[model samples]
Target: MKIKIYFRIIGLSVLFVLQSCEDFVDIDSPNFQMVTEDVYNKEKTTIAAIQGIYNQLYVANFSTYGVSVLGAMSADILLARTDTYLPFDQHELFSINTTDAGFNQNIWSSAYNMIYMVNRALEGLENANISDDLRQNLQGQILFTRAFTYFYLTNLYGDVPLLLTSDYDTNAIAPRNSKEEVWLQIESDLDEAAALLNKQTEYKDGERFYVNLSVVEAFRARVYLYRKDWSNAESFSSNVIARADLYGLEANPEDVFRANSKEAIWQITPDGVRNFAPEEATHFTLHVNGTGTTITGNTALSDDFLNSLVPLDKRRLWIGEVSSENEHSYFSKKYWFDNDGEIQQYSTVLRLAEQYLIRAEARAMQNKLAEAISDLDQIRARAGIDLITDSNPGINKQALLDTIMIARKRELFAEWGHRWFDLKRTGKVNTVFSSNPTWQNSDALYPIPGEERLKNPFLTQNDGYGN
Candidate 1:
């Protein structure tokens, strides 16, 4: 299913289902409620419910579908290419102004919408007559989804109102919790999800998009990494990496994300036919006319970083191009699908490469430099580059750490919103991002969307936006 158009459907459904009771009464049927109930009744419905969650990934609305993409856009890997035309830059959040209605509103709405559906699904499963095993699995999925949604919300908005229960009425006006409180809830939800989900099973097709025990663990590791709980982060990441045969470093760093290739530990993409191209157009300048005629300007990769890649590194080939035509700068080539002829493209959410990198970083932080080097070597070897074989091998801790982080930058360039978050986690936000260069610290987190803040007066605006 080309989930590209799903936001419109979801938006309409929300309007029809969430507007005044008169609209609900006017409807020929209870849309959200009936679908919620019907989906819970059957295994197929539950399966579809999971698919519906993946649908959120491919949709275009930042609030309902496009938040991750938007987050990445504001980061370093990708550029908006089109000025004022793209909502991200036009509203100036990328540059830290934070008054953009389109940018903030989309993020707020998207997080809440996913939360709403996930809560509804959890409630549906609770009321369902499914077997305990089946119910547990469904619950696992719901728990992970809720945690995943809140992870995005809290990370972006800091202290957001925690909505653990599905009681829409009472939870509507709840006050914002502290960032620490929100992370606690996130940790709890992932723990429950990991316990319930079967880590042994491998889901095929769209089923892979849904959260599993491993996914929850990986995310928890990510959360811990964000919170700087390096030990727990290392532990969770190690557990996932122990299943290395199932989820190891991609054999070819290039093949790891060849649009349709399958080394993905987790990914959410639209059906190619009607969806976006291999990657979003915002990251790359497209030569659509086939004569190198520029169709759109892309967010160029940093020249200093691009030059740091070793000559033999395969990822450099995959990401950087030698274009002499349009101003001659390094542009991202990760999603260069010429045939698609449109903007929206398949976006990658998670990959095994990140797991390896995470494992390496976590281990190094734990002072396991040799072990960290092994992990880092796996990535470098796949990129056809030589391993770090220097005689001065006594763990130059900070240098090794820097190398691993730099490798992350090279490996995951434009894949997701890594640069900004990576910078934030490493305390490089101010150093890397000078005052309002592209976007600033006040722009650090997007403003609480105007509509959401209005609806819930308890919602506090993120810093730097109030002025």
Candidate 2:
């Protein structure tokens, strides 16, 4: 199938400009008959349709800013420098107008748009006259994409409407599903995705840009870890770790974000023109001028969080200092680019380090202290930090878990809101934020977007956010 088939089916004019390849088949209009006949009939067009779902990740609202920025700002790892993002930085998201059209609104609407696209592709593939192999592959890709989107949605908003169909009527009136139900669906999707996807070794070009079997397994490990399914989490994470040839940890901490690094299980490339650089770089990088660079970023590493990193850790190299006339400030260098001025960095959604953390936490929960310590030590060794040893430390299960949490904060800080999600999953949001005068128990979950509530009357706002 040709890319036009997807654009026409979704009525997306913006995507039509992104495609440079000549159309394989021409259509007189974007009608159902034309799309069904021209798109669903061919394997190429069907693959292109699946690619459309991946393309959505490059959108500003999806991974670039919505999840990464909002997630970081709401946590202790990153601090907002201006009033524009202060609401999130100060934990005032509950105070934002439910009806306001802003980043929050964009995050909600854009995620659902991606979900709808996946569902549409799935619907088309089901009835399309295609081979079993092609059909299964497409199904796996679509399911993984849907599950990924829902993981973010459910984490941010607690409960979300699960739209599995492309039909507008069905989606419009769909009620919010419980977080448990949504998670169950996510697991089911990942299970099916794992069954259908080709292994990482089978992927051409060693690409981490698209979903593969290892990516599915890694995500399954993460989902299980979040659900406290310790044994399954450890097993799934161990499965990914066993495939070291394909998904080994990068030797250098800075190399993890480089394009197609082995550490990355899944990453999203920047879109053609508008999204030329990783979105996090814009907020985290210092401003450069004639005199010297100044740390005038929209966001920066929080002082308390920055102080927590030990000098011996290789991960500390990811933070840099810039000096102006009389003052100095610090910023994150995780997304820094090379001197060549090309966009060689990608926003990594999942990586090998996280799998190690997942297994460590799972092992700790299962009382496999020694194994958990070994996994933690592997990540620590890469970071140039002191390893946890049975002889050097008298570590109990709770103490080891605490150590693992701190390791996670230092290892994964400023990367896609891992700190924020970690705190929420471990039931430490209140304990961590109790010092803030404005902090409330209900602030754990963001309010459901107002426009969505208005569109679907069945939708209810999270507690403490009045409907």
Candidate 3:
């Protein structure tokens, strides 16, 4: 299918206004070179370019700062430990505001930048006469990256413009597509990618950080679950589980987040990419290590959140540290750099433990209560909990689903920006999230960054933003 590339901002608006007449001459310049003929000509170079895309995933300001740090920590489940100057404590960092003291352009720019790279790679591959095998590998990588990004964008901002192509000179002024349409595109891309991706290729560091067929299947399953397609969700998730030889839960819950661990289906390895050591303070909301005056200082793991951890569960002690003073409850131990403050070794994205949670939820939805419990037990078993065979006798299916949700929260706590999405997707946003009064309105679905809206007139704010 021919997807039209849109680059409306190329010649329009004030950005173009300041350019000289020479700039206009270069606007339609064909001499700029094609990425296909120029970049992807060599197999090694093409693979390196793909690796560069993965490198971009490690940028702290974009992935770590916006999504993992802010989006993950600012949930009601977590509280600010210090009250000094954390922008997220007030819940204004990523929100839409007429004034400009704090605006989160990270989500907007990061996703688009990543999308731009993927688009370039994809366009380059399509034009290049690469071999079918290598072409499929590169194609799968780009498709998975695109789908993963759009999924995050769709969840954060309900309705988003689906810009499929990167050709700026032709299509422009693309209006916002409904969440359903975006999701459909995402599903199509992932399905295609899953088929094309290789399960045998190991990542540079020999971890599952790189996208593979299994990871794409896992992603497809999660995406289906998000759209409430239980059958497809179960199918994809079950497929991944059936390949238990390839991926499964870690032996210990703590090992899942430790520096190096097997059983990782997909993750973003923080290798020579981006170091969070010096700038780790800015990446997190508050100083989990209590050094930064940002969100970490203002907030911490809530006592209720901490207390919720079962006694035998080692994850509670593994994932957090007690506050120096008696003021804050629990500071996150997940992202701490352990090379005596020299190196940061952690995966920003995780899959194994989360996949189990996903399977459990799907099984519960299908009323396979025993199977659901079995999935839950896989996670619990590592955490030192007995198998949940006879735990629920009188509770209904919905109640069992609720139990699954709680288990998900406990199992995947603070790994990625999951809690908020889990709460929102389950239609429990208004119900469970109501305890904190600020998190009201559909605007909770992330605000389109002001800069994006300012640049493109087609993008509309979610309802209740202006009025």
Candidate 4:
């Protein structure tokens, strides 16, 4: 029932972070005194502290950076060229010594740092002189933020220290919790967040960058599906899918990642970013590095993944290829060059298509084949691929599950580590990587960062990862 809270205050300036109808307070602006107690005394300052977390998310190591380059390489979805992060690409990340693990350490450290900020804000809000309405909004937003983050932490690193307070002495030496323990906290935080906000909570200038009731439901649906709470998953996902005015599948599958797209349920904005293309686009793109001839970059779509798609799949339009001296490879055109010379592309974290996929899988698991196919076919139809209703209308439950799995891989590849998490959660990881002699079942969880273990002697490493 108890959770530890890690502590750190990221030096933040909310000046350029949010560009909405109402301006967020800029911490660095001369007008505000940023003392710890005073930061939450005013409504504007409290919201600024919350939005600062959102701004820093752009700098976090986690996220669907150009579809989560780190996790994609760990899965079969992406490949890195020679002389890159080979350990991640080869499933041998565990071989790295626990001491020199910034490669993996950054991910763990970054997330907990963000969690500490959320905890600090939540504490400040408890006695903040702000109005009830504003206080509730900030509280709900950060609690959801914390739960959203913990979902990834527990998924990537099996059991993690559950931190809930901003006290440094306790968190610095805290022990780990079971994965089930982490999920309970994640759900508990989400349930609390859901109670504080509602449908009429307007999006900032009608943008999806900020979380709302629908965003909370979409994520809760994901958590339920992962837990195999089939009926709850079906019901929650159905709620979001039915919000036709706020969400819909883009008829042209390629338009889904564009900023302000109807399909985007929640996104990280590129506002005030200096010359930024989305992280995924920047990493996944391959172009001539020296000569105007050869394509170069550490990351690209893997042939194993690319070849799995049915020929003529419209989603292929998201890919671009370049060949040099008989070496040809593909890159994602999913997020491409911005026209009109403004950075408007947003990093998509959750989308409507994923909601349908979640619903389809959830419904199928419960033997609701007809309803499941109806959901699956929506993705396939928009994909310009063969629809389940058209070709496999009477498919058996097992076959329908198989088709839905393929649909998820094809649709959600390289986005937020979906393919990686899906393979692990569905128990298909070892089979997928059986050819690699270096792989083991233990590779499913990332090693606890050595730096963190050094700081907290109580932190233990994951299986197959030595201290």
Candidate 5:
């Protein structure tokens, strides 16, 4: 088990440091046949190895507030409150400061570091000395993590370099893979994770913090919906939706984001590292002077996004505001608490509402218009809005699809990169932002961080960018 122990140690490197880090940066190659590996002797240590990756996600630039902010800014949902965020909000990215700036640290570099941790843990698990159940749990967690990270990577930057192993020597110079190839790997990883996690009927320690079977199905449902595999998307989403004992829509709209809520299929506890409320509140909560001129925080909900919400919608209540003599600034309060010491809210990654949306869109695309409206009604019922079935029972498939997309924007805004990825995937970026001169066809994909290309010459920049 020398290999297991050695790889676990590499995971420590992933958690503690990742400056200019590419995938699996330290070791040239894992000497699989090396001497006695001892890290997996106890189940606790094995769990810890996987736990380290979760912690990495919490503190890592990409996970905490990075994806939400960058995605919101790039899309129409959020407007820049500070000068530093102007580039992202304007659909242009730059690196005037250094590679350590927001874009590189949050998306490119940190995501690769996240993948590295997952790869290390996956390799260690192959010959681990743990019990079968523990091994399965660990494997399920690692595989899901790899897929989750890659989901954002491929969506944010088209055709990323897919590195699945911890062999730095082979991966360092690797060229980018096609977007379709990366997606296939994502589906493959999720398929294996589903098999590994299938037997676990409950969450780890009765908390949704850890990945479980439902989480796997929920994520796969999302991936399938993105890929336009409407059949698989509807099926996987239905799997999660059927588990009523463990999940449901919180009757109260505000209660959905609270810790351990009934609606959460999977959530990351804000109980480590910084030990604060979820980054959703900490980052998106805004401060403004009682005047037209001043605002704080990196971003605030954009005028377009704010105007899009119906005035009486319950979901609109999630927006907090600071009003001035002439203007009012709005911010998202999904997490509800922003003070660093208060930990009431967990950063929600996956929830049942999203599955409903996914199912709705998938069913609509498959011409199951009535079933699609039924699914859409679940979320609307929670949001205290008029149900699609009641409002318009005869809505056409294309109109239902369009309506679900709008619901996704309203319901899932300021969460992950849902809106940003949605615009790109659905070919609506140009249509949505047609009036804004700053929006462009080329801005759909993020630039490959220049630092990454410097290290790996095979890497190329996205459209309308330079070295």
Candidate 6:
């Protein structure tokens, strides 16, 4: 991938070009010549346009906090110390309202802004005089970005507006599409991306940041898994797993987040010196001095979650603690760096481990118990937990699925919205949150951001949040 070269140019030029547009989805750059002709005239400039989308992704609050922290807070794994995060943590209690213009709004706006940029790039690519190979690659990249954005949008706010073009007037009046329609579009984009993207080896530098064939396959597996399309989920996941030459499970779980890990299928590089720390580390780390006393810590692992880890599990090493006045406080070590304070991690969007879990769950749903256990064993082995033995005998389907869910909780926690999405998709939100008096069944879906509904009268609020 020529990602390094594109990103280097993007760091310098992305901001200047982005300033030309006023509306959220408009792509009319302030510099008329630069936006209309120059951006599409040259291969480098076109690449930069695509790179600009990546740049937006690097700092987008939605990607950094919305998907990671907010997602975790919505689940049972993490607790919020600040009021800023409390709305998400206590969303089930009606803390999150249509008017709350915090994370919920940021997530919605940031996602649409990126989608707007992507649509502009796609239009530019279509009209550009670029090579067929280069054009196809760029198309794949843009489609993947759009699909990824819609995936989150639909999941976060049900029945989101699906804007396919950069026509601001058309998009402004666009109405929400059904979740099913949105998912179909997501799969279509991923399928096209998989077809057009080159194999991992074709890229100049074996960069995992850019969209490649393996990444497409992996994401397809995830989408299928979410849709409960077991066969497709298993098949797509297996495709990625078979490409061991390109991706594999890292022996150490921490290595999965390191800058040079082979396990990373796709990751967004952090920006600047201070910003070089991955978002998770910046938000999740609890500051403590050499004396082991807590100085400042914003979030921590819930006691219930911490106690759930088995003693010998290697993943337990990814959690650390500091002594407070009377008790020990713990935080996620998944994104932690050294005390010397150097940036050593990237925000991993997709990796090999998730494909395994997806396949395991998909297979279990299909009643392929033995095969499902085999996939789960791979993750268990990597986590240093005891693998489920075939000799255990007479494992029921529900029991095996319960085992897979537990594995997913431990293996994929505090990453993107996997835990939160898992609970929602499995119809377990009500069962899981039954004890919380404030949690209504409707809490499973977040309300559409109030500002969005205001701008487009066609939009409707989710069930619990009145229009």
Q: lDDT of candidate 6 vs native?
A: 0.77
TM-score of 5: 0.90
What digit string (tens of lDDT, one per residue) describes model 5 on residues 1-467? 00111112234333332321331444555453232134454576666656766766765667656787777778888888877778787776753344324454456767887787677677777887888877887898889999999998889889899999867777789899999999999999999998998657587677788888889999999999999999999999999999999999988778888778999988885234335667677688877655556666767887778888778788987888886655678898887654557566678889999999999999999899999999999888878879988889998878898999999999999888899889888999989878778777877877787666766799877787755
lDDT of each residue in 1-467, candidate 4, tens digit only: 11122212333323322221011111111212245466676677667777677766766766554128788778887787855567777777742453225557667766776776677778878888888877887788889999998999998898999999756667677899999999999999989898887554357888778988888899999999999999989988998988898899998877898887999999885345635777777778777646556678777787877888878899998888887764788877777666666666788888999999999999999999999999999998998888877786889999999988998888887788888899999999999989989988998888887767776789988988876
lDDT of 1 by residue, 131-150 (tens): 88888887897788788778
TM-score of 1: 0.83
Evaluation by lDDT, superior candidate among 1 and 5: 5
- Considering summed lDDT, which 10 consecutive residues are worst modelled in model 2? 20-29
- In candidate 3, what residue range of length 10 has the lowest lDDT sum? 1-10
C-alpha RMSD of candidate 4? 5.6
* lDDT values, one for every candidate: 0.64, 0.77, 0.63, 0.77, 0.77, 0.77
Question: In TM-score terms, which candidate is top?
Answer: 6
Q: What shift in Å separates residue 173 of candidate 4 from its native position after superposition?
A: 0.5
Rank list by TM-score: 6, 4, 5, 2, 3, 1
**2 or 6, which is superior by TM-score?**
6
Global lDDT for candidate 2?
Answer: 0.77
Off by over 4 Å in 2: 1-37, 94-101, 198-201, 270-275, 288-295, 390-393
**lDDT score at residue 393, model 2, on the 0-100 scale:** 58
lDDT of 2 by residue, 1-467 (tens): 11122222232322432221112122221224345445677676666656656665666374668778878888888888777788787777642453223667777767776776676677778887789988888899889988989999999889899888756666677899999999999999999899888553445466677778888998999999999999999999999899877778888987999878888888886345323567678778876467664446678788897789887878888997777876577788888745666787888888999999999999999999889999999898898778887344558999999999999998888777788999999999999999999998888888787766765689988987786
lDDT of 1 at 373: 91
How close to the true structure is residue 415 of candidate 1, measured as C-alpha lDDT?
A: 55
